[model samples]
Target: MNPLIKKLADLSEKKSRLIIGLMSGTSLDGLDIALCKISGSGQSTTVQLIEFVTAPYSEEIRKQLKRISSVENVKLKEVTYWHAKLAHLHSEMILAALRNWKITPEKVDCIASHGQTIYHYPARDQQELMDPVNSTLQIGDGDHMAVKTGILTISDFRQKHVAHGGEGAPMAGLVDQILFVHETETRILLNIGGIGNFTYLPAKNQPKEKTFTTDTGPGNTLIDSLMMHYYNKPYDEDGNVAFSGDLNEGLLRELLNDDWFEEEKSKTTGPEFFNIPWLKEKMEKAGINQDELDPKDIIRTASELSARTIVKSIQQQKITSETAVIYVSGGGAHNPYLMQRIRELMPANEVKNISEIGLSPDAKEAVLFAVLANEMLAGKGFGMEIEDESKFVNFGKISFPD
Candidate 1:
């Protein structure tokens, strides 16, 4: 047998796996490295976050990533170069994490990487008549990661989902269903990264069709973009700037008028859709002078827009029952204003950080990737049967260390 195949088979027999899950989101804030010990799979999946750290990207690195991360014309050579460059950087981060935890790379079983999403164009928009294909690209070569880290790597998980007719997003739903769902309680697993998305896991008694996930529009992307352009801050830091400013209702309404909001559920979007240019266009439409507007007000409205869109999406679900709880993760959860507003909007539903459960809210996304990787190695694969029937699709492409 090939050494790689034998090693994988050996791993499958293990009771658990020490997997390093890496997630670099659209926020470009940092690379979230989660050292996870995952056991079992599917509904029986369990994960313990052994260690975690967010290695912040230098401005130069961030700029290079952003350059290749949108519809804007970029050099193909640059994109090709950064794909491996990012993988090398990620490997360095992984090594740093291992050193920090006083562990050796050999002790780890595998690396599950979400990679860096340079573009996401889900096929939800058929009316456009331009192009209709579910396409997404996440760089950071898994082969390079595998070679550099000397660990079997599973990366580019989204491509499989797209190939299987999924929107290539909210893939965390499977893990959430396995690890976070309650027997009787309907739970909303909300992740507010650069783009906000949630997995609505109905009670076990509910029909499986009722269990769905969708992107709830802007998360921190709009606010973060404004902060960067205006204040030179990557983020609002707990939304203090937002708290200090009054909401601009007119601009808020204009921002909320995007057709993306009215589109069908289970959709996905990114900073590519909700960034500064998008906001400026909305302001222009609303007859608001972008130059004259106070920076704080813009930030305040962006934060409120995020909260409102989230609430609107939840409301669309129409999950009526006082037993539901909203478990929020991702950077937006740290924003007190956003959290308070979400709670205010949905007073009946209990809103809490995922930390109240076993997983740290900050580590949830990385941990989720780890869970998916574990499932690929050991558990029964997922058969998604919602709008379409997808059979036993195992996400992630395996890269052998050799």
Candidate 2:
């Protein structure tokens, strides 16, 4: 047998494994590096976050990524160069993090990298295309990561979901099922990142088909874009900007008027769909002059849009009778106003940070990728049968260091 295959087989049989999970969301603010100690697999899986860090992207790198991200056109050269360049950059970030933690690369079993998402055009959103298929792209090559870091690497996880008839998003459902399911309590794991999405985990006793995951429209993407345009800040720290202004009911209604929100559940979206240009078009349709309105008011309305859409999505799940626990994670969890709105909208359910359940809100996404890498190595595959008829497929393409 090849030496790499032998090493993989040996690692799969181990009692536990050390994996470094990497995530770079649509926000393009930074990369999340999570060092996790994962054991078991499937429903019996357990994970302990050993170390985690957010390596902020340099302004230069952020500018380059933004130029190609979600845009209709771009320089192909930029994409090709950055694919390999970003991998090396991420490898350096991983090495620096390992050094800070006083750990050697050899101590880690593998790296699960959710490479930066440049474009995410689900089939429903790409009607104009000649081949409108469920498609998504995340750069940063795993082969480069493996060669640079000298660790087994698993990357481009979304492709497998697309190949298996999924929209290649809200992949969290698989991990949430394994980690958050309860015997008697239905749980809603909400992640408010660049895009707001949630996994509806019905109680173990409930029909499995009732559980699914879907994106709840815009999360922090619009608000973040507004902040950068208005205040030169990457994000609204603590929702202060939003709280300072009152909501515009007319604009909010216009924002939500789109038919996309009325569609059936279990769909996916990205910044490409809900963006600054889209916001301006909605404002124009509402006859609201951007120059006349206070920037804070617009931002406040945008924040409300996020809160309303999220609550609406959760409510659409028809989860009533028993109060479900909604554990919130991602950057939006830090926004007090957003959290308050969600709580106000769902008074019966418990709304709390994911830390209440023993995971850092910021590290949850990164830790999830680590859990995914673990399953690919040693566990039986799992899936939400009702959402996609495709068979349960293992995610992540493996890259061995030579």
Which candidate leads in TM-score?
2
Query: What's the C-alpha lDDT at position 249 in model 1?
Result: 93
The global C-alpha lDDT for each of the candidates, from Candidate 1 onward, is 0.86, 0.91
Index of the highest-lDDT prediction? 2
* lDDT at position 225, candidate 1: 84
lDDT of 2 by residue, 1-402 (tens): 989889989988988999999999998999999999999988789999999999999888999999999998999999999899999999999999999999999999999999999999899987778888999999999999999999999998899889888888988888888899888887889999989999888888876437778899999999999999999899999999999998999999999998888876689999999999999999899999999999999899999999999998877767643458999999999999899999998888889899998999999999999998998898866655546535565888999989
The C-alpha stretches of model 1 lying farther than 4 A from their native spots are 125-131, 207-209, 384-391
Error of 1 at 268 (Å): 0.7
Give the residue spans of candidate 2 off by over 4 A. 207-209
Q: What are the RMSDs of all candidates, in order?
A: 1.6, 1.2
lDDT of model number 2: 0.91
Clashes of each: 0, 0
